[model samples]
Target: MILVLEKASAWWDYAWLTFKNPSSSFVEITGYYIDRYASVGAFLRIAPNSSGTLGVQTHLLQKGQQYSVYVTIKGTQALEGPFKVQLPAAESEGT
Candidate 1:
């Protein structure tokens, strides 16, 4: 199974993580920040030979701060990354 971090963004007090699974086997993903403080763990089952997007929510996402995200597959020794993502600065009001 292969895991890819598609996109990551922050709004208010929440962070949204988007992922893609492209493989012929069901995948279970566990993700967390490298700090090991604010973390989220869940099993994402993407059907075989199909592509699906998963949105995971977490708290305390600072704007413009680069985050190291760690992802691992359940029941397997497969580790994707400490993927680095920089949250874009929040949009200002009135464009």
Candidate 2:
């Protein structure tokens, strides 16, 4: 199993997280962000040689603050990340 968190794009309140299951068995993923103590139920069923994406919401996130993101495979101790993500300051209205 492979997990990756894509660089956050235009969305100020969420980030795109991708998971890949390269083995010949199906896998499920559950995730959470440490800073907010919020759990994101990705619970994806990724088949062999397949991948999926989940949108991790940052609604509780603050600009310039770093958050630790983690994902774990269901029914196993396999875990990934403390993936650090920092949100850029929101653009001000009316320059």
RMSD to true structure for each model, in Å: 3.2, 3.4
Kindly list the per-residue Cα lDDT of model 1 for residues 1-95, writing each as its tens digit. 27776777555545556666667678777554444555567666766655544454433555656777676677767556766666556663123
- How accurate locally is residue 12 in candidate 2, as Cα lDDT from 0 to 100? 70
**Candidate lDDT (C-alpha), each:** 0.60, 0.65
Worst 10 residues of 1 by lDDT: 50-59
Clash pairs (backbone) in predicted model 2: none
Candidate 1 residues lying further than 4 Å off, grouped into runs, are 35-39, 54-58, 90-95
lDDT of 2 by residue, 2-77 (tens): 6545443325777566666667777777655455486667666777777777677776677656677777778778
Q: How many clashes show up per model? A: 0, 0
- What residue runs in model 2 are displaced by over 4 Å at the alpha carbon? 1-10, 92-95
Leading candidate by lDDT: 2
Highest-scoring model, TM-score:
2
